[model samples]
Target: MIFVSLYLFMFCKMEENSGHISVADFSKHLFWDVNKSEIDLMRDRHYVVRRVFSCGLMNDWNLICRLYGIQEIGEIAKQIRDLDPKSHAFIALIAKIPEEDFLCYTTKQSTPQHWNF
Candidate 1:
């Protein structure tokens, strides 16, 4: 039990300190349409942040949170127009930011709600 705990601690520290995250670290389907090796985490922060929020699992979320933290992710989320509704709400609540701060939320408001009728 101690060994597993120690290993987990070390793994989390490595992820936190490492500035790079590869596509392969995520689920296979997350980047199916792109060359996994070519995607640079820092250069493609917008893309990675969007896909991770929209389609990534809990592990993926945790990884990004560790790498970028809730504040950075929330800032990235602000510019992502296609972020899912649930994901948007989750981030807003977690980041303690209002829904109006998110581009997705504001854009959504600009359009007529189909569900309203």
Candidate 2:
């Protein structure tokens, strides 16, 4: 009974983790606004790429690139309208894409410093 239970437990653990990338592996501070475990990579790719590339460190950047590739990441990042200039430039350079090709660059907003409450 003990041997069978142990085997089952290990097998289940392996099955659950096989070829799956969980958000929990990212920097904890990056996901403070949401429940980390509920994030599905395929379904939540836009959110994941936006958060990791915008707010995460180099390691996080490398991880996402390895998992999703530069082409895919650039495609997603280009669509985000509010990405900061620094982050936008970084991705544009690494992805080897012209700045004008990005939607964010083509439709950038003027500085919001003049807005009043």
Candidate 3:
């Protein structure tokens, strides 16, 4: 019982520090349609962080609450709101990506059938 409790506590602490989504995980979910090269470029250029921040800020509160939990939403909002001007500007730059782009990235599509000659 003691070991279980300790493990649970550690797990919660780890989750708390990592935020609800890490850059890598957020990238996977956001850019599911993009090839690995694009994903790699986004990661290398810190585009993942920008996208996560933009999604967090622009997405509805209900969605945010669903993803991060009701309790976590407040903390996440506060952290983003508290970001310095320079950091906020950087996030805003990438946040300009169109809603259509997000939709295209997340939408499910059937695989194309190969043609035989």
Candidate 4:
């Protein structure tokens, strides 16, 4: 009975953590504001903003399309499909951008080891 209870507890803990988006994780990884338009980000030359358009994440692509009033989501999706059909569409697009760009946008105060990646 004790072993069975412990096994169930561990299973539940794993399920809770899987695909869970914690606030700290979201803030640390995604530096861009969802409310900001693509034009505003372009004018500011934000790294994440630029990459989100060119990158493969469907969620980011859709959000940018909606925020910017652009109708290029399908086109972008086609491009991503052509490039890597096996890639995960919903995962965060942080790894798509170059490390240099991340370092440039990330402050030391916010991300102490930003350059390590």
Candidate 5:
């Protein structure tokens, strides 16, 4: 009886730790937020963020897509639009613009070198 009780306790704890990662609409996961903050600190130090790509497990890619206005079905479309000839030309034009007008995604850190934030 004692052994059975101990096994059950350990099993429950494991499940709790791997609790269902339900994708909340807008509210970020409290635990994930904490982890991100730590990662940001490491990034400031230029330490672990360079060594590790992505640390914590992401809940669901689909949820992020929906929130970002790019649903799963439209993902390919979104990609195509980004790389469209017109968009490419626009980006080229913008690249020629002065630094003050140049607004683009920072490539200083690739996904492999991305911190949680």
Candidate 6:
């Protein structure tokens, strides 16, 4: 029982720190443009979950709630994936960072200005 409790505690701490992990670390692990600042992820797991959800990436509510204290990342991801191409583009525009911003960061462009509106 004690060992089980200890393992659970460690697991929770690991997840907490994982959510606090830097964008660079996450990018290195995933090999994709997260398109958000490091500070954003460090804020809170819920924030990151919401960001991912906004991108239409959350579909499994139970998993999302368990993983990120939210309940929609899996559903959103599925919805985005199911969208028609043009409609997906529109949805992406509504939820994601502007293409220019994502491009600027991906290309390592310095002093890049994000969209004002």
TM, every model = 0.73, 0.73, 0.24, 0.24, 0.19, 0.24
lDDT of 5 by residue, 1-117 (tens): 456434533443344324222333223432344444444321232222111112212233222222222222122222232132332233233223322221222222233423332
Task: Write one digit per residue (lDDT tens) for candidate 4, span 48-98.
Answer: 334554352544543443333222222233333222212222111322332
Q: For residues 14-61, could you state the per-residue lDDT of candidate 2 as single tens digits?
A: 443345556766788888999877888778889989998668975566
C-alpha displacement of 87 in model 5, angstroms?
Answer: 20
Q: Candidate 2: list runs displaced more than 4 Å.
A: 1-20, 110-117
Evaluated at residue 110, the lDDT of candidate 5 is 34
Scored by Cα lDDT, where does model 1 land? Answer: 0.74
- Give lDDT tens digits, candidate 6, residues 1-117: 456434533444455323333444432323244544544533555444444334433232222333542113222433332233332343234334343333222354344336422
Error of 2 at 113 (Å): 6.7
Per-residue error (Å), model 5, residue 92: 16
CA displacement after TM-score superposition, residue 69 of candidate 4 (Å): 1.7
Whole-structure CA lDDT of model 3: 0.37
lDDT of each: 0.74, 0.71, 0.37, 0.35, 0.29, 0.37
Q: Largest TM-score belongs to which candidate?
A: 1
- The TM-score that candidate 4 achieves is 0.24
lDDT of 6: 0.37
lDDT of 4: 0.35
TM-score of model 5 (CA atoms): 0.19
Worst 10 residues of 3 by lDDT: 96-105
Point out the higher-scoring one by lDDT: 4 or 6.
6
Q: Candidate 6 — worst ten consecutive residues by lDDT sum?
A: 56-65
TM-score of decoy 3:
0.24
